[model samples]
Structure formats: C-alpha cells, structure tokens
Target chain A: MPLKLFELVGRDAARPFSPYCWRTRMALAHKGLSADTIPWRFTEKSVLVPYGSERVPVMLDGDRAVVDSWAIANHLEDAYPDRQSLFGGAGGRAMARFINSWGDIAILGGISPLVLADIPKLLDQVDADYFRTSREARFGKPLEEVMATRDQAVIGFRRSLEPLRQTLKAQPFIGGDAPDYADYIVFGGFQWARVVSPFKLLEETDSVYAWRERLLDAFDGLARKSPGFPV
Target chain B: MPLKLFELVGRDAARPFSPYCWRTRMALAHKGLSADTIPWRFTEKSVLVPYGSERVPVMLDGDRAVVDSWAIANHLEDAYPDRQSLFGGAGGRAMARFINSWGDIAILGGISPLVLADIPKLLDQVDADYFRTSREARFGKPLEEVMATRDQAVIGFRRSLEPLRQTLKAQPFIGGDAPDYADYIVFGGFQWARVVSPFKLLEETDSVYAWRERLLDAFDGLARKSPGFPV
Candidate 1:
C-alpha cells in the first residue's frame, strides 16, 4: 500500500514551488514508496482543514496525519526502515535533522520576501487581487511602492546564505559524503529558488549551484516532474 | 559512564530558552543525563560556529555535533532506547512529530507578534538593540499596530489548539497517558505565552487550562523557568 501525499498545485502557493514540499516528495521517491499524489488548490485549503494544519506536503499513512515535511520524511523513514532513507545511519540521521531545522529557520525566512518581488504576476495566476489590495492597505502604498522594500530584503536574504556557503565550501553536501536529510532540505529549498524564483540567487553560490544540478540529475527519471502536485 | 550532553546558553540569545531548546532539556532531564550547559553571549556564538550551526541547543555527544533540536532529541532517543522517550511507539512517535510540527509553524507564528509586543522593554535589557531596531523598522509600525493585525493569527493559533484541547479535556496531558513530546511542545509554547501576554487565550479552552495548571505544578521544584528573554 502506497502512502498518501497532498500538495498544492501550480508553481507556488504561499511560497512558490516550495522546497519544503519538494523535500518530502524527494524522500518518498528515495524510499521507493509510491504515494497517491493529491493535488491541492491553494484557494481551497478547506480540504485539509480536518487535519487541523493548513500546510502543504501533508502525508497520510493509514490514519496517521503528518504535516511538516521533515516530520513526514521522518515518518516515512521510520515506517520503512529497510529502504533508502535520508537518515540512514547515526550520522546521516543527525544530518537529516539538522538540515530540516535549517530549512525551517534559515532557508524559509531567507527566501520568503522575494515572493513579493513579482507579486502582481504571482497573484494574477491565483485569480486573487487580495495580495495587491492587502499590500496597499497595509503599507498605505502602491504595490510597486511596497515592493520597493524588497532590495534590502534581498540583501538580508543573501547574507543569511553566508553560513551555508561557508559550510558547503567545506564539504560536498551538508551531511558530508552521502546525501541525507541535509541534502534533501537544502536541495528542496534551493531548488525552489533555483526553479521558481524570478531571482537567480543560487548563482551567487557556485557550490550550491553545482549541488542543485547534481540533485536534479540524480533524481532525474525517478523524479516527479514539474507541477508535481495535482491540478 | 553517563551520556554527555551539550547546550549553549546565555542571558537570552536567539537559541536561548526557546521551546526548541527546552525540548532537548526535558529530554535530557528524562534520560537522567546532567548536561554541561555552556553559557554563550549573543556575540560569542563564534565558539560553537566551527560545529557548523550558529544555533543554541546544539548537543554534542562525543564528537557528534547535533545542531538541531529535533535531531538532538532523536539522537538521544535512538542512542538510548532504555530511556523513556517522548516518542514511545510508532504511533506515539508519529503523534509527537505532528505536535512538534504544530509548535514550529502555527503555534510559534501565532505567538511571535505578541512576543514582540514589548520590544521597547526588551531593548532596555540587551546591550545591543540591533535586533529590536531592525525588527521594529521592518514592521514599519509600532508593536501595538502590528499586534492589532493579529486577529487572524490569533484565530489560527487557537484553532491549532482545539485538537489538544479536545484530547486533554479527557486526560491530564496531550499524549493520552502521560506527558510526552506533544505535551512538552504545547506546554512550553503556551507557558511562554502565558508569561509574556496577558491574554488568557488558552483559558477559553477549558480542559487545556486545567492541564496547563497541572503542568505548572509539575515543574514546581525545577529551577529552570522560561523568562521571556531580555525582559
């Protein structure tokens, strides 16, 4: 019996092509666990309201409801310990946990502001002008005027990458040697920036750029292609 | 030989006294491991930077530098199976993971704006006011103004609590039988909020309030208290 995975369709919902969601998908693929993919529409998160968490990449194994990507990934690994897991050994497990934490605190916070850079186009696809109106109302400024605040946000985002950049320069991946939770996390997040963002921030970090390419190639045929979620 | 545990502490750094940090602390306490708490000032995170993550609650077991809380907790549980883990069995483990996810996303996000409500007072305690200044400047509004925008955040936070409220209504804690990771996550977060904000938001949820009172009494003799950092 395959696991059930729910993801939001389209490029990105709250944050486009969220690396967070992709990490779980990658783990499922890595584990060779075929999941019944449930494509979700952002506008109707009510479908998931019963689970009590309004987040994407929720996995249901039997009746178990796992919301966070790392948690879902952890569940997958534990449920099927013999398969290839992001947390394979003692070190790998630690690496996986660390990477997941980094994704939550550092990676997500770093890239979130840029979603506003192309808010008009991003919102147009959703058929909701609420983001524009909300920005205007909240900032008491025009969409463009509020978006003007993104440059400094970009700088701050770039600076947050310094620790990762320095760390990656020391090793091939965050977990050293084999790809673990760290790889999936950094990959999933950076891939969102790599694939979806109008900004090409990964180019600034050559090792990260190379790492992204490697992950894409490694997961090539087995990888769930673009718009991995249901439409 | 006893299991060696590491924690970076300070007056109130980013990694200081967070629910994430306390999760590891409680786990350590449960394991009968007396940890060597390294007090780190905000500027001196450099001491642990070589271990890779700048975050506090980084646990070093031998040479293994486990940087994230979830990872640290898992490491402890996996390494010491005899110890009573918050993750009891597979089912219990899954539930704990779900609750932990809720803490990071909905619970923390819901509580953060309120936490920053007294930024001016927090600024008085810390020698450097850069974080507070930057946070205030980013909000582009007073703490009162930002807090006024919190109706939805409050709603979401409270909604997240409903399941635990329903569960705890029947039991003394979230994990049905005893206090586990779920209880720890819920208790630490709400405890932090109970001290920081006057709003007894959790009070409306009856069973949860009774559970909270019982939990408050559970820690009566423990020296550790969550002082809402820098205040």
Candidate 2:
C-alpha cells in the first residue's frame, strides 16, 4: 500500500520546524515505504479536516488515516519492518520515544521564539489581514500580546538551549554514534531555524551543524533539494 | 529484569490528578511495572539534570534514561509486551501513538491555560522563593506575561476538543472501548485541571468525566486521593 502523506508548503511562521512532520518523513524514508507527499497550504487546511485537524503531515495507508507525527512514524516502522529501523532494537525503543518527546517539548519549545522573530517579515510576504485575523483566531490574542509572548518564549528558549547544546557536544547524534528518529526530530527544529531565520542561529553549534550536514548528505539529492516545508 | 522509573512528587503541580505525572503512573499500572517514586522537593531537580533536563516523569529502564511523559508512556508500551497492551494490537499502535502526540500538542495545549490559572494558589502552597524563581526561569517574564501565553495555548486546545470529546462520547475512551496510552495522556492533562482549578471545566463533557471516573474507580480510592505536599 502506498503511504500518502499530507504536509504544508512553507514553514508555518507560528510553528516552524514541525518536528512531528519531520519525524514522519524520516520514518517513511527509513522504512523504505512508498509514500507520496501532498504539499498543503496553511490557508487550505480546511479541505483536510475530514481526516482530523487542519494539520499537515497526515499519512494515509490504504484507507487507514494516521494523523500526528509520532503515530505516522510508528506505523511506517511497523508496516515495513524490512527497512532500516528507526528504533534500532528493543532497548533503543524506549530511548527513541523519550528523545522524540524531549525534542517536541524541549527542543521545539526552545526554538519557537527564535523562529517567530522573523514572523513579521514573513507575514508581510503573505496576506496581512489574514495573518492578523487567523493568528488571533488560533492564539486568541492580539498581535501585541503575541509579540510579548514571543519575547518571553525566546527567553525560555535560551534557557533550554544551554543544556541541549551541551548534550549535542557530547555525542555525534542524540542516539550516539548514528542518527535515528531523535536526531531527525531535533534536526528538523534546527533546520527550520537555519533556513528561515535571517541570522542563522544553528551555525553557532559546530557539532549540531556537522550532524545536519551528515543527514543532508545521506538523503537522495532530489529529496534533499526538494522545496519542502517543515510541515 | 526490574523495570525502573523516576518520579518527582508534584513535579508539574500539586493537584491529585496532575495529568502529566498521571501518564507515567497509569502506564505503570497498565504494564504492572513497580518502580520507585522519588518524591522531588522544590528546587531539587538536580536528580534529573545529570541525566537530562530537569523534567518530570522520568523513567530509567536499565541503562536508558527516558524523559518526558509521552516518551515514557511509549517506552512502557513497547518494553512490556504481555501485561495489558497500551497499543491493543498491531493495527492500533499507530493510532495510539497519534493520540498520544495529539494529546501532547492539541489536547494538552488546549487545556494548558486553564490548568495554569491555579499557579498563584499553588505557589502559596509550594516553596515560595523556589516557585517564584522557577516561574521566572521557565517563562522569562513576570507572572502576568507568562500567564498571557496560555491564551494561545488554550485556543488551540479548544479547537481540538470538540471532535475529540465527540469521539469519546461515542466510546468509553480515546482508543475505542478500552483504555490505551492515548486515553491516559488525555486523562492526565484534564485530570490536572480537574484537580487544581476551581472551575469544573471537565464536568461539561460527560464522556470525558466518565472516562476519568473509570480510571479513578479502577485505581480504587488510592488513585482519587492526593499525595499531599510536605508542609
């Protein structure tokens, strides 16, 4: 069965990396699962609500609908057991799950404020009225409040980054010698910051950048060069 | 092999039904794993920092140090096969994982503002200096500014709740008739709110309340009772 994936086109200014989408894509590649990506526009998510939320990175295996990145990653892993394993072994499974969650809360939470700093510029490129109205709808706050929230969020991000950067320095990837699901999720967040931010914050960490280089080098050039957004 | 766990008493909040902590506890109940619950005092997450960030609901199984609620829950389901399966069967694992992530981002994020509303009352009950300092550390702004972030978090949560609550109305739990990891994660967040908030937000939904009651009833009086603070 062909795995059909639905994802966003540009990195969402509100949520840039979308570790969830990255995890699914990584799993699809690792599992050797034949999956097609459907590029979705954020404004057009209403069309896909039948599957779940207007969230991108929804996967369809035959008739079964799998939304959320963690679930999709697992389904692909189980569905195609012959491919390279994301979890590696039974012992590694727990570690993988823990790292995935850590990436979501710790890494993504840390990186979000930094990503949002450029949102005003991105909003100018898109629809201004829609951006203002839609953001308030989603966040229930005016632009001024959201901006203040972003500043606070960035402070929180900086605090989290210290320990995380230290950890990255200790190992080649989160899973030690090789890259795995954990690495991919964290990499997605870092990649989002790298590609979207004008300042390029990821370059500060040589170890992290080295890991990103390895991941980019490992993938097919076409997939690597594809105009993909971090769903 | 002995299953291991790391618990920080009132790690997230002091409420009897802290949803974040409950995910780990409920999973332990499901897998029948008896591990130590090290009661954590305020400002003493030094125990967690060496292993990872000072995050709650940590699980150290053998050599692996698993952190975060979703990660620990998934680890338990994957590591323990025979005891009541959190995934149910092969087909259900993906759905279970999705529900887990959905709860983390959508469900938990939705209800977070409401949950945090009680922080002031909770602060009085906790170590005053530590509580205030910790708030400053995580939110990086005054309590008011930190409080504002909830507006967005809650909006996203409410958007996800209708469909989720409807799904629960049709069934006893998120994963259909029986309880699964997803149900527990959902239960944890709401339970935290129910325990802390003066407002009875969960009472509005029968199925959601009933589901909590089921878990409360299953764990007997033991689950319903709070583990009091060390005053």
Candidate 3:
C-alpha cells in the first residue's frame, strides 16, 4: 500500500501550505517516496479524529499513524533506512533537534506576522472565519492590525535570521554539502509563506535567498511546482 | 611535549575564562586529553604573533598550532579519532556548525552586556585599561551604562534562550544522552558568564538552568571547579 498523508490546504486543495506539513513533504521526497495526499482544511477537525490528531501533516504508513512533524520526520528516517538518510548520523539527529527548535521559533514564528493577514484571503469563507477568529484571539488583535507594520517589522524578521545567514556563508545547505531534513525543517516555513502570501521574506542578495532557490529546485522542483505566488 | 593552550586570563592567572578557550578546554577534556594553560592578557597581543592569531585559545599540539575554538574542536576530533567522537558523525559535524553560530550569538553575545563589566575588574591595571578602551568603543558607551538596565534586560536574554530550553525538554544534551561538542558549544558561554559575573542569567525553575547544572557537572565538575562568581 502506498503511504498516505493528511495535509493542510485552503481554497485550493492542490496547494498544501502548512509549514509542518511541508517538512514531511520534503522528507518523503528526500527518501524517494511518495504519499497520496488527503487534503485537509482548518474546519475539518472531525475528519482527523481517526488519526488521533487535531492538526494536519499526520502520516499514515500501513498500520502506523504518526502525528507531529518532528515525529513524522523521525518515523520516515527509521522506517526507510535503505533510502537517503534524513539525518547524517546520530549526532546530526541530536543537533538537528536544536535546529528544529530554531526553525519553529525563528523561521515559522518570525514569518507569521509578516504574512499572517494574507493567509485569510486564500482560505474559503469557513476556514477563513475559523482561522481569523482563532488567530486573532491568540494575538489579541485583528490579523490586519497585527500585520499592519510588517513592512517595518520584516527588518527585524530578517535580522532574526542572522544565525541561518551565518551558517549558509560556509555551507550551501544546513545539512552541509547537500540538503537534508535540517534544510526541510527551515524551508517548510519559507515555502508555506510563499504559498499563502506574496510577501518577499528574503533579499535576493541574502545567502538564505540563494539557499531557498536551491530547495525550490530540489526533487525536480517539487515545491516550485505547487501553485503559489512567484515569491 | 604536552599540548599548550594560550588562554585569556586576568589578574588571577589560574582562572582562564575566555568563552572560546573554555570550548576548547571542554572539548579537550571530552577527548580525555589535557593541555597546559599559558595565561594570556588582553594587552599581550604581540606575544601571540608567532601563532598567527590575535586571539586566545591558540592550541599548540606538539609542532602543530590550532587557532579558534571551532577549529580546535574540529582539529581535536580529527586528530584524536580513537577517542570519543566530538561530533556524532558527518551530519552532526555539519549541523553543529549552526549550533556553534547560535552559541556565539545567543549564548556568548547574549551574556556580554550582563557580564562584560565584571571582566575588567578581574584584570590588572594594563589589561583593564585596554579592556575598557576597546570594549567601550565597541558599545559606544561605558560598560556600566550598557550593563545598567541588565537587571531588566536579562529578561530578554533569558527569552533568547527559549529555543535552547525547548531542545533540552527532549534531549539530555544538545549532542544527545551524553555530552558532545555541541553541548560544549553552548556550555562554554555559561561557564564564561559564571567565571566573571555575579548576575544570574537563568531562573532556577527553567530547564536551561537544569541543563547548565548538568554541563557543569560533566567531565567530573571540570567547569564547576574553575574559580568564578557563585552565580
């Protein structure tokens, strides 16, 4: 049986845009495997009840069901030992945990305010309503207001990426000579931002921008082939 | 001949306290190797001219000289392969680079304002003058002014460590169950802070505080045994 993945989508089921989901997508591609996408939406919580998860990016591999992006990545690596390794070795796996934390905070959290308001426009009416209400409650303000100063806030967002920029100065990928799960952990956020918002999160001259372009070209341009803005 | 490391010190030559040097110190101890310390002061740049570095932590192993903490760590790993691996594997070596960057910025750079002023007090008159002149020029203010609001600014420094705190929630060490070079990368900074400052950088309730305690106890209390402020 082919692997199946529950992935997040908006108005267009073809464009799966959750950063966590993107991590799994890249991992599967890196392993030279494919998963049949079970397109999911924000309001479709009941559909995921069988999978025991309230979020998308849940992976179903035969009898095993894995929830959470980090868990799913580990599952893929362990389950497919014969394929290209997700982490280079035991040390890489441990160190990548730190990177995973960084990706969550610096990459995903940092990008949220810059592109959040734009996300609602891509959702259908119900998901848009659910997303706006839930997110606004989390931020304690309207999404529009939160994103109002994104033009200026992006400078700090760019600055927050200094460690990543510094890393890329010596390496072409976070995984060293080639892209690995570490690259996917971070690219997931940039890719998600690209799918939902037209905001340019990186400067063309930045090493991070060049790294993203390389990932966009990975797996036969798998991410680039998805429907999204040119950004 | 034993390996000789030129390490930064103040009036108390026995308390070698440069963060970079501490990284190499911990790494050397991890490899179960010992190096004799050549206590160095800020004004003694001309003494290190033959080593081709303007910094401390220049390690001389027999006829070979290694400079910089990161390079020294790599040198130790490669030169002493029969010992425990500094990086778990090739992937670990690559990913650790990112952690090294974060260590330099978040751990070392983050602790600077809170502890920098305390450093000059540890130095003698000549080195103290050079430290105040150079560092004040770098910060564009007196060290006292920069550190004045640190009691409040420490909250932000603590916040910057959130990612590291998140990582420790899962693994015992950044390098996994046992401490590795990655753990040493960040611990070197905390050890540096403890050596010079009385200011508390971590809340006792925080996981990071626990992690620091564990690292200090590693290699038979190598860091804890060093002379420093109680904090």
Candidate 4:
C-alpha cells in the first residue's frame, strides 16, 4: 500500500496549513518520498481517532501508524535510510530537537496571535466555529481580541526571529550549506502562516524573508506552488 | 607548543566569566584536550593585539591563531577529528550554529541585564571602570539602573528559556543522551552568570537547573571545580 499522510486543511483541501504537517511534508520531500495526502479538517478528530491520534500529519506506512510530526520525521529517516538523510548525522538529529522546540515555541507560538483571526476565514463554518471556540478558550479571549494588537505584536514576532536572522547571516540555511530537517522545522511555521494569513510576518529586507523564499523555491517550488497568500 | 587560550577573567585570575569563553572551555574538555589559560581582563586590549583580535577565547594552536568561540570550536573539531567529535557530523556542525546563535541571543542576552550590575563587583578598579563605561555605552544607561528592574526582568529571562527547558524535558542534554557542543553553547551562558553573580537565573525545580547540574558534573566536575558564586 502507498504511504498515506493525514494533512490539516480547511475549505481548500489543496492548502494544507498546519505547521506540524508542513514539517512532515518538507521532511518527506527531503527524503525523496511521496505520500498520498489525506486532507483533514480541524473539527474532524473522528477521522484520526482510529489511528490513535487526534493530530494531523499522522502517517500510515503500510501496516504501521506514526503520529506526531517529529516522530514522523524520525520514522521517515529511519525507514528510508537509503534515501537522502533527513538529519545529516546523529549530532544533527539531537540538535534538531532543540530547533524543534524553538520552532514550536518561538516560531509557532509567536505567530499564532498574529494570525489567529485570519485562520477562521479559511475554514468552513463548522471548522471556523470549532477553531475560534477552542482557540478563544486557550487564549482566554475572542479571536478578534487576541489578534487586536497583532500589528504591534508582529514587531515582537519579528524580533524573536533574531537567532534565525543571525544564523542566516553566517550560513545559507540552518543546516548550513544545505537545507535539512532543521530548516524544515522552522520553515513549517512560516509556510503555515503564509498558507493562512495575508499579514506580513517578515519584512522584505529581513534575511529570514530571503531564507523563506529559498525554501518556498525548494523541491521545484513545491511550497510556493501550493495555494497560499503571497507573503 | 602547548595549546593556549585567552580566557576572560575579572579580579580573580582563576575565574573565567565570559559566556563565549566558557563555550570554548567546555569544548576543549569535551575533546579531552587541555589549554594553558591566559587570564584576560576587560581593559587588557593590548594583550590581545598581538593575536590580531580583541576578544577572549582566542586560541593559539601552535603558530595558528583562532579567534571567536565558534571558530575555535571548528578549529578544534577539524584539528582533532580523532577525538570525540564535537559536532557529530556535518549536519550537526550546521545545526550547532543555530544553537550557538540562540545561546548568544536568547540565553546570554536574556541574562545580561539581570547580572549587569553584579559583573563590575568582580572586576578590578581599571577593569571595572572599563566595564562600566563600555557596557553603559552599549546599554545607554548606568549598569545599576539596567539591573534595577532585574528582579522583575528575570521572569522574562526564565520564560525565554522555555525552548531549552522543553528540549531538556525530552532529552538529558541538548546534544541528546550526552553533552556536546550544543550543550556547551547554552551552558556557557549559565556558567557565565554563575561565575559573576549570585542571582538566581533558574529556579531549583526547573529542568534547566537539573541540566546545568549535570553539566557542572561533566569532565569530573571541571565546571563545578572552577571558582564561581554558588548559584
């Protein structure tokens, strides 16, 4: 059986937008493998219940089921050892965990408030309601209120990218001379923001902007070709 | 010729406090290598002028001069490839750069204000004058004023450490399973703080605090043996 990946999407199934899913998507491309994309909506937890996970980016590799983006990335690397290595080496694998944590907290968490309101617009009525209600409870405010200060909050968001910016100043990618799982780890957050929101998360002059553009152009413009706002 | 390292110190010659220098110090130990430490004070620019750089952690491996902690690390890795690998591989080498950047900006930068005033107390008269003048110029305020809000500002510093904390939650070290350059990169900042200040950077309950303790015990308590304030 062909590998199948449950990807988070909204009204437009073509635009899979979960940051975690994007991480797995980029990892699959890096490994020179392809999976049949199963567009999964936010409110559709029942679809993943059988897989023992409520998250998208759940990968079914023949008989085995893999859940979580990090686990899926590790699974892809181990299962497809002959393909291009997702992690350059064991050291890279360990350090990538730190990058993953930073990406989740600094990148994903930072971008959430900036794009929270824009997200519901991309969802259908039911998914939008679910998204807003769940997110509002998490933020302790309505989506609109959460995003009310985004224009100013985005400044902090951009400032938080200083480590990435400083790193890019010395090397072309986080994986140094070439893009690796570490790059994918961070790019996933940007790709998620681009797919859902029109708000500019990065300035045109920012090195991070150029880095994102390069990733968008990677794999024959795979990410850029995907349906998303022009960020 | 034996390896020589210029280590930043204040009044006490045995106590090296610069975060970048601590990174090199730990990297050297990780490689099972030793260096003759040349204690450097803040006002001692003339001492480094012969090395063609004005920084601590300037390493002289024979006639070759390596400046910057990162450069010194790369130099050590390349020159002593047979030793335990500082970077596990090329991929690790690349990603460690990101960790290095995060260590500098997030960890070191976050701790600076909290410990800024305490630093001068560790310096001699001339060095303290140089430190205050130079640091005040950069911060655009008196060091005391900068540190005045630290009791409150340390909360932000702890929050900024969430990435490291989260990573440590899953792995024993940033290098995973064992300490490596990535661990040294972050531990350097904490070590720097420990050397110069009694300020509590991490609560005893934090996983990061535990991680620091493990590092302190690494290389047979090399870091713990060094002269520093009890943190």
* Per-model TM-score on C-alpha atoms: 0.47, 0.47, 0.99, 0.99
Structure candidate 4, residue pairs in collision: none
Q: After superposition, how far is residue B108 of candidate 2 from its true place, in Å?
A: 25
Better of 2 and 4 by TM-score: 4
Q: How displaced is residue A157 in candidate 2, in Å?
A: 2.3
Candidate 2, residue B158: the lDDT equals 53
**DockQ each:** 0.04, 0.04, 0.90, 0.91
Docking class of 4: high
**lDDT (tens digit, per residue) of candidate 2 on A1-231:** 667877655544333334566667666765666577776655666868889866767888899888888677677677777887776543344334544555666676566545554444443445445555776677576655655565456555555444344545545555555666656766666655554454444443455556666776556732345333331
lDDT of 3 by residue, B39-115 (tens): 99999999889989999889999999998998999999999999999999889999988999999888888999998
Query: Highest DockQ, which number?
Result: 4
Poorly placed runs, candidate 4 (over 4 Å) = none
**Tens digit of lDDT per residue, candidate 4, span A11-80?**
9988899999999999999988999999999889998898999888899999999999999999998999
Clashing pairs in 3: none
DockQ rank order: 4, 3, 2, 1
lDDT of 3 by residue, A62-82 (tens): 998999999998998899999
Q: Which residue pairs in candidate 1 have backbone atoms (N, alpha carbon, C) closer than 3 angstroms, thus clashing?
A: A12-A16, A12-A17, A19-A188, A39-A230, B9-B40
Q: What is candidate 1's lDDT per residue for A74-150, written digit by digit as tens?
A: 78878889987566443244323424554655666566556544535543455246556655676576756645666
Question: Which regions in candidate 2 have their CA more than 4 angstroms from the true location?
Answer: A10-19, A117-131, A137-156, A203-206, A220-231, B1-231
lDDT of 4 at B34: 97
Candidate 4: residue A163 lDDT (0-100):
94
Candidate 3 lDDT: 0.93
